[model samples]
Target: MSTFDEKLKLFAVDLYKINAIKFGEYKTKVGLITPVYCDLRVIVSYPQLLNTLAELIIEYIKKMQTFDIVCGVPYTALPIATVVSVKNSIPMVMRRKEAKDYGTKKLIEGQFKEGDNCLIVEDVVTSGSSILETVKDLKNSGIKCSDAIVLLNREQGGEKLLSENGIKMHALLSLTQLMQFLKEANCVNESVVEKVKIYLQNTQVDPNVLIKNNRLKLSFLERLNFAKNPVTRRLLQVMCDKKTTLCVAADVTSTTDLLNLAEQTGPHICLFKTHIDIVEDFHPNFLKHLKEIAERHNFIIFEDRKFADIGNTVQLQYSKSMYQISSWANLVTAHSVMGKGILEGIQQSEGLKDRGVFLLAEASCAGSLTDQSYVDATLKLAKQYPDLITGIVCQNPLLLEEPGVIQLTPGVHLESVGDRLAQQYNSPETVVLEKGADVAVVGRAITKSADPAAEAVKYKEVLWAAYEKRIASQ
Candidate 1:
């Protein structure tokens, strides 16, 4: 199979080639004249393309853990849903637009009976009213309807409406994404995208969530004052804003590799974390390029300095060093051994208020010195400097509930054991989901992949899925 992105782009391109999505005033099923119309019912003409659609829906069903049986909304989605159910051997069902008057004389079609989990599949969601009708029929039959899948979400309050009716709406693409792909492929221009945006903005159920991907990015100080920890807030905010919760730890020894990785995969990450002192042949030019990558990619620059000195000395190290860390980093890591004095010292630096710091609540080294007492004291110390502290580099999720304290767990890998030197490692699932870390800091696992960008994409999917499950449980 192709990469997830390639599949979506290809699906849309093939659909456009067939003139499935046409631009012109047309009457919708609901009786509204619209400038554009999507007729996915065209898939019936191409079995090969229809098979791909089934495979894509199956991919999402497996990833999302959505349904045991698939049901089509009795129109364009019927063929795809039928193909998916039969091909995958999943039970298929549907509520007809009208009850049959002939043999069987039934409103519901399919062998599925009552009390089965049904997933509603549809071509598009404009207002979500049609799917709700299917849900109503399913509920009448005592069958549960908990999820709906769509090829395209119109971004017209349909998702919010479905969610309100106790169904999770999963779409392969949204209007905003479709616009982006079209513009990138030169299929449409900026003016056309702007017009589509205007149409979508008027159909929002929650305008706040739709305005810029449901995020309100805060400045360093604003993040501090947030109800959650600044680091947690930052991580979640980035995930919501950029649709990813993966951060790359540029652990390479060469500045060349570091910049290349950032430039190539920057858009998929929430932050580019670096140990500036370790990069070979590092210079002001290195920092300049690194800063540029972060700016262009919309990710934060995190210097993993792990400062352990007294506040006064650490302050100088953060600012006056040959590298001049304070000039570029949006955040840094520090150890909390000296209590409030460590934070007080760092905060004393000029222009430091707009930057944030993550305390070393615990380390990943096996049997290292940071214990429960240390973590508790660190939490206490952090509260005293709420304005300056963002979160902690924690192995344990002890500080999660403390207001505004985000836990960022390191030592994550796709596969690996402890290093010969005694450093431990955990999978992204272990650290992000099991330990409740807001962000997963990964290094060689991704950077060393045969294809780093594809590897990063895989990590993002798993991490974001786990994050969604955690949020639902909460």
Candidate 2:
């Protein structure tokens, strides 16, 4: 074997010896239980292992065409970069998780001029957020960074996400490789290897197909690979995993009725949407119980706030208001009438990455002023920020087939055509099958039924059947 190859084998063994890769039931940051947890943070304690890892990274870096300096992600990657810099005589810079308040108060603590090409070194890559964050900081300081090197890649969506941002990811080792070494060494059983393989496949988001002209052609399982927003991704995963696309709009006026409806219909629905401001008995405990039910039922909570104010006002209304919707709601509704600033404001709130907004492009209510132009503008805005806007709430399919922006059709009813208030209703076929919408939001049809749970089951069956038919026909 080559020298680099020999070092790589030794590095893998060292990783196992140091217990950097542990075999057990561990809950990931997003609450998914995994059979193994690869924590590279422990590698810093072993100088020899750390040096070998840095050497492996340096060997890979030498193959690169060119780079000016090297930078490491905060905390875990700091020492790795330090070793690589010292051993290879490469200049190094540091990125701070939080900017120092005193001294120079620099976010990036290094002496580097602008326009220098910096290669980012990270200990582990998951969603590629850390490398992207460091890239953003470097860009703001006029430093150029187009490549990143990680000790190990979890093989989730990190590489794809980084490529989407014009950054290339180079990993010294992948999770699959580590698993192979463990399996060969008898460090983990076959079942653990299979479990990790399944986990990797579940989180892998491939970009082979474009959604431009293929929106109607892709199934939920296929579309999950393209969704950028975490909430959107989780929703698609839930729908595919649960085999339902029914969203129950709990429009009841009391928290008691809301919780009752949620518990009854949670099994058959992917989203439990609410207008929390209308709840007569709202309390902190209400939010707690609702979230607990959602967790147990494997559905997301959507608060239909319909926010349409200025940026500053909407920011406070989303997170700092009496309701604090951002604290619990995984999905929210917002009107793009006030411009993209409304999106910016919402994104600035806490836990923005975990939450998503649905733009109201068309309403099921009659005489709604959302015309074609307004819908077009709303879709245009949503396309600009795929990470923030999950989809558009509309009565009809959009003319533009934008990727990753799902369609949520509301006012769905099985029998009713229209109410006295001019609220138009469509069947599950019209929404999911005919109009190419992803979700059907049914309110009074199920909520006001004699047995909400049974009624929800009916909607769920029809909705999932329609979705299956749509994708099969494609």
Candidate 3:
């Protein structure tokens, strides 16, 4: 029910309490005397705690989609995987270290197909040798293992070893997170916390090198350099949360009218999209005033010029033109048809440092080439100049389902044949619910209404209702 960060905070606090009561100097199965230990086995005894944790895991997996088949690695992970599978309505699998002579003489005991993308779940990984062996067995059994989810990572070579074997380690809690949790809960002394921090720091590993050595599959960010930017990531998040974002595509006919519409709808929206060439009297003063209003009301001014010119020409239009896009707009929409060189020019401009360049993908308007040649071009540009791009402008807001691209859908309305006007576009509610539209851009519905503020409120309420419904369903 809570946000990811909130759930993690609560888990840290609870885990700290459990650890304090159970941990002390003890001989581990690995034959090492440890001052602190975690027996998440205790969580099984506390049904409420176990349920909460299962719910959290389900929520996280649903959001991340990091795994295809959820397979627990041996004993401790089996219970956690079972609970999570029941909560999320997904099937579970278990991996055994060695084949049992009595039962089926099988090491992997579950329904799984060859090359199924499987995620191994574990309670904790210390040396990681056991999990590596488990991974080897799974791979030998024709299951593709690329990811591992664990309760805690001790910040040791375990993560590196797993990664070296082509597996990513996703942990709900790390040693650092646990140490901080213990300190906040007053379950451990400052000296013990310091020792843990020092131990983790000294044993830190580089994930990039490990990933390379294993010839593992690259993550979304690694595949597309554009996704590494923080601005791009934030824009993607805005697009994903169907409630707070409204993707608008208005013809820039009059600055005053556009500004008025933005003010009326801005409070409930995240992006106010525009086509700068359509504006009648575009000037620096008008641009400055519009930017001011956009900031005041908590929305981004997205210039939808769709510039498809040479590098020099695009740079001039962005900085020296009457609109002065670099000065006013938080994000500028551009056509990647001009090649990566033009995108490089846009990025080289100092004034456009914080500005995001949303690439034109599947255009909202009909008779556009986005479906055929444009889509391929956009994908290539997205890979080539990912650092300069922010998001993608498309009618299929569902494309925003990707981790890095913000899906901006225009032509949204509460009621109008406007849906007929753009035969394929979705209504505001439909866009939010079914299409996963981050921002619903409405034009005539709000700006042309008798009472713009009231109309905007109606749209906002509808968006919120859709958001609540989706969250409830989840």
Best by lDDT: 2
> Which parts of model 3 are misplaced by more than 4 Å?
1-227, 230-243, 248-252, 397-401, 419-424, 471-474
Model 1 poorest 10 in a row by lDDT: 211-220
Candidate 3's residue-wise lDDT over 147-181, tens digit each?
78887887667787787767888888777777776
lDDT of each: 0.75, 0.82, 0.66
The residue-by-residue lDDT of candidate 2 on 1-474, one tens digit each, is 577756776778778888887887886543356677778888878898888888788789888967778898887888999999999888998886544323564667878888999999898777676687688767767899899999788887788978998999998878898888767777777998898899888865343432223566677776777788999889989998898999999999998999999999998999999999989878877788998999999999999999999989999999998899999998999998999889998999875459899999988887889887998899889888888888999866573245466789897888747878888776787677545678899998888899999999999998888887766753
> Of the candidates numbered 1 and 2, which has the greater TM-score value?
2
- Candidate 1's TM-score: 0.52
Alpha carbon deviation, residue 229, candidate 2 (Å): 0.5
Q: What's model 2's lDDT at 271?
A: 94
Q: Which pairs clash inside model 1?
A: 228-404, 229-404, 229-405
Better of 1 and 3 by lDDT: 1
Across residues 19-56, which tens digit of lDDT does each residue of candidate 1 receive? 88777677654445556567887889999999999999
lDDT of 2 at 426: 68
